[model samples]
Target: MSYYDEIEIEDMTFDPKLQIYHYPCPCGDRFEISIGDMRDGEGVGVCPSCSLMIQKRGEASNSSCGYLNAGYFSSTISSATRDLIKTKQARHI
Candidate 1:
């Protein structure tokens, strides 16, 4: 299967609440893949607004359940991110 691009996991933004990682899509949508999908050995992130998809790479070690570790995101994410998540969650509710 071919992909529109190959992106590193570190480049994607992970949402702890949703357990999903997302990257920008030219279609004005985000390419997303859930942590469950990765743990199941699926690495493809799909854009909801288009047919384009990207391959996610860089899971060299288990993050406890076999995807990425919480620490990986922790180091990359700051408290501001948590606030953002909260704001998003509030809107969805």
Candidate 2:
């Protein structure tokens, strides 16, 4: 699975309400993935608006996001990042 770039987990934006991490995509959208999935051993944040995807590097547990004392977005990431690929078998919505 090729990605545009490898972004460190710390560089992604954490949305507490959705328990997800997001990063800006050049496609004029955002690449989003859920925090739970990250903790569950998932990587790759996909953009909702286009075919582009970004690979997540590092670990959520190592990130400084206070909400992640290690815990959980985008199956419905954000209005900007919703509907990204659900890498897991269990879909959030």
Q: Pick the candidate with the highest TM-score.
A: 2
Q: Each candidate's TM vs. the true structure?
A: 0.65, 0.66
Question: Taking the tens digit of each residue's C-alpha lDDT, what string does model 2 give over 1-53?
Answer: 77899999888887888778899999789999986677567797989999988
Show pairs that collide, candidate 1: none
Clashing pairs in 2: 20-73, 34-73, 36-72, 74-77
Off by over 4 Å in 1: 60-93
Residue-by-residue lDDT tens digits, candidate 1, 1-93: 999999998888877667788999988899998866875679999998999999988862344232233444666668786465446435544
Query: Scored by Cα lDDT, where does model 1 land?
Result: 0.74
Predicted candidate 2: what Cα RMSD to the true structure? 9.5
Q: Local error of candidate 2 at 63, Å? A: 8.2
